[model samples]
Target: MRRVLKITLVSVAGAALALNTAACGGKKSSSGDSGGGDGKKSIKVGLAFDIGGRGDQSFNDSAAAGLDKVKKDLNVTTEEISAKPDEPDADKESRLRLLAGKGYKAIIGVGFAYTNAVVKVAKDFPDTKFLVVDADQCTVSGSNVEGACFSEEQGSYLVGAAAALKSKTGTIGFIGGVNTPLIQKFEAGYVAGAKAAKPGIKVLPAKYLTQPPNFDGFKNPALGNEAAKGQLDAGADVIYHAAGGAGIGVIKTVGGAGKWAIGVDSDQYNQPAVSSVKDHILTSMVKRVDTSVFDFVKAVADGSFQAGVKKYDLSNDGVSYATTGGFVDDVKAKLDQYKADIVSGKIKVPTKPGA
Candidate 1:
């Protein structure tokens, strides 16, 4: 049984931490500063969060979960920086520089927006290891920058299969937060998976909350609701969204319309913010950002830190479809078979739709 994804479940415990205390800029604070008797020096890891920050209950929060695990299990100290919506690239650069400037051994940028900043900053701080999540665009060429990218399409494929399998109307919908290569990965995988499950299944045209240069799409639930309503009105009984916080609206609309919704990044079924509509959430395309984040920090702490691109995929347990709601139980065996085939390379999940 060769593992496809590197699945390591880390438990996150504690209040959410962020470095956005100041109105105009980022802030940094220490957690678990208590002394350790082992006499091994503690390492400082800094996280620069994406738009929704620590409490978005999605992507950024998943990264925070990894940080919390390090704080509890490894006894490491950490600091977090939250990103403001539509902030300039310079601000992102400054945040990354700040973390590296503060003597932190490893500084992590939580989203693809940090791609440019990580590439530019890592050149100056050669001693500091930089990790970027979701930004494979960041060049690791001759620099100390490592990207922790996930096979989002592979995970989306599973959920798409679930959506097709579970849809009673023979139609499904997908909503993306922003129009980018990354989000497109989610769209492509989902559509492919859906069709694979049920040939000739009608997939509605994918909708975007916003395009690039306007990332409010990731944070705006109003937009998500509107997009979802459009889908439901078009006869889509099941919708899957990779819209971050905005996806909350999708879930709400699905529940209100008596349809089904699939979540992203983190498990929406476990989130209190979406509790009211939990029953409507069929499952989540769980992208384990925490595992990647934790692995980087842990490697540095263990004196085995390396700089390069590390990918998580179905083959490595880096991505999968969640089953917390148990709505997919009937299709679990079939989904598991698909998972096995993908892991065995018999099925190659497409990163681009129709590819």
Candidate 2:
């Protein structure tokens, strides 16, 4: 049985991290030192982001929300660095090294792409505690590294059911940022849930914007738009996208066509970039990267930092289906029941497509 944890979303003013635009390399950003004169040292945290950092209004933004909470409640000083599209692993290693060398005691690599880099850098700075989101920490040899992993498939399942229930054309579509094993989890749960909700529903073949070693799929809005158009043209009236920043294009295209679009990572219904198409968003598979990030930082600050994989799933409220725009209001009861069933282990969501 999975351990259940309750998480509350905290909203605080001035929670946004201030980026130093003048920083030349790596687009590095830092928050002002919040150490007070009361003889207590403020905890310094380093956050390394994946592609489409911060304002992508999706994955990175979800991580940013956690950092923002840390700043507001923990009074922690922080630094942020983002990855470039298709950048080499060396760059990621350098970014980790730079943060560790700067004496940032708690460093977080915002995506699984930093798995190798985090492991490599953890060996060099054993005193610094490191957490990588989406990667299993148990596989690491370093004693100071931990991982924040989420059961994204669980949340995706709920939204998939929603898409199937609301889809008028009885044909739904899925778009992945990259054809990685991680993204495949979303595809798996979605297809399974859609079929479970409405047997014999027509699901379009999953489309991937890019493949490995080329992560441009996560950041390319044009590619997302193009993929969405293809699905829509093929008679898919409901589309779910786990395409990170590129998901904006999916929302735009799908909504423009007056079809339903399901968002991933963050709630797209409230995102300003997709405000014009907010009504078209049926729901979002809300993966609480923010909660995991905040929990990791809080653990480090409170000296409770443990080096191991910490998994978040539906049972813990770490991932959920968003009901923004009230578009799914009519089906909320059914969605909640499915969520309960998943939590009780009555239904097991698949981590791989067609499994």
Clashing pairs in 1: 4-315, 4-316, 4-317, 5-315, 5-316, 5-317, 5-318, 6-316, 6-317, 19-27
lDDT of 2 by residue, 1-355 (tens): 2211111122345345434342334333345445566555577788888887778999999998888878777767677777776777777887788878878999998888888889888998988999899984225547898888889899999999999999989999999999999999999999988999999899999999999888988999999999999999999999999999999999999999999999999988989999999999999999999998999888888889898788889989989999878999998998899999999999999998989
lDDT of 2: 0.85
Each prediction's TM-score versus the true structure: 0.93, 0.92
lDDT of each: 0.84, 0.85
Report per-prediction Cα RMSD to one decimal: 6.4, 6.3
Top-scoring candidate (lDDT): 2
Query: Candidate 1 — which residues are off by over 4 angstroms?
Result: 1-13, 17-20, 24-26, 33-35
In terms of TM-score, which candidate is strongest?
1
Off by over 4 Å in 2: 1-40, 136-139
- Cα deviation of 55, candidate 1, in Å: 0.7
